[model samples]
Target: MYERKQEILTKILRAGRRTYFFDVKATKADDYYLTITESKKFTNEDGSFHFKKHKIYLYKEDFNAFKSILEEMTSFIFDKKGEEIISDHNTEQKFINN
Candidate 1:
């Protein structure tokens, strides 16, 4: 018998060569948690591409602290950077669209 985790919801965000996956999954007891995965694409010298992924498993107990810190960090960045597009990829896209 094969056992697999059930996913309640899935959301994906693609940014340049990186993709982020937010998956809400249920445990054996039907308790829900979240998994956040960051997948980045890299090209090898042999003309091949590969993906490197990092994942975080977040449970209900840590949700509040996690959200609070995330919001705080993002707010700090915005306060310092003032909504400027600093990445090369974003700059190129902005010029292309304009």
Candidate 2:
């Protein structure tokens, strides 16, 4: 008999060529933790696409500090750049859609 670990909640965000997954999972003792996964798509020389994934696990104890730093960093970026889309993909996507 095997018990499978399952995510209690999940959310996904897609940005350009990258995707972000936020999953809430439970431990054996029924404690909850969060996993943040960043998956980026890359094209090989043969024109095949593959995804590279990086994940971070956040335990309950570190949630406050993690949230604080993440908020601070994102706020700093917005304060400096004022929410500008400074990527070529943004313009390209607009042209492609129209």
Candidate 3:
């Protein structure tokens, strides 16, 4: 039987109408992994809001490849468009990691 452990660390990044959650947790054997959850808010017809969340689970063995690709992709974007956000709906990006 396998069981998950409590979260070891967490971080929250708020970007406009969306929030990204980064959680570090351990597996049954005490191996560490990361879970990233992106939560976006949407408004209903009555002006009420709801949240939709999508999550990605990442393991240790693929960390290097994952990080390398992410860096490469972001670098390509920066090389093309620079750091400034280019959108009419551009909102101030705030990041909180702890």
Q: Across residues 1-98, which tens digit of lDDT does each residue of candidate 1 receive?
A: 98999789888777777777889999988999999898889999999999999999999999999999999999999999987877645522211110
Per-residue alpha-carbon lDDT of candidate 3 for residues 26-89, written as tens digits (9 for 90 to 100) = 8878898999999999999999999999999999999999999999999999999999877888
lDDT of 2 by residue, 1-98 (tens): 89888989888777778777888999999999999898889999999999999999999999999999999999999999988877656632211110
Best by lDDT: 3
Candidate 3: which stretches are off by over 4 Å? Answer: 1-4
Q: CA lDDT of 50 in candidate 3?
A: 99
For candidate 2, the clash count comes to 0
Worst 10 residues of 1 by lDDT: 89-98
Q: Cα lDDT of all candidates, in order?
A: 0.85, 0.85, 0.93
**For model 1, what is the error of residue 28's alpha carbon versus the real structure, in angstroms, after optimal superposition?**
1.1
How many pairs collide in each candidate, listed in order?
0, 0, 0
* Global local distance difference test of model 1: 0.85
Clash pairs of candidate 3? none
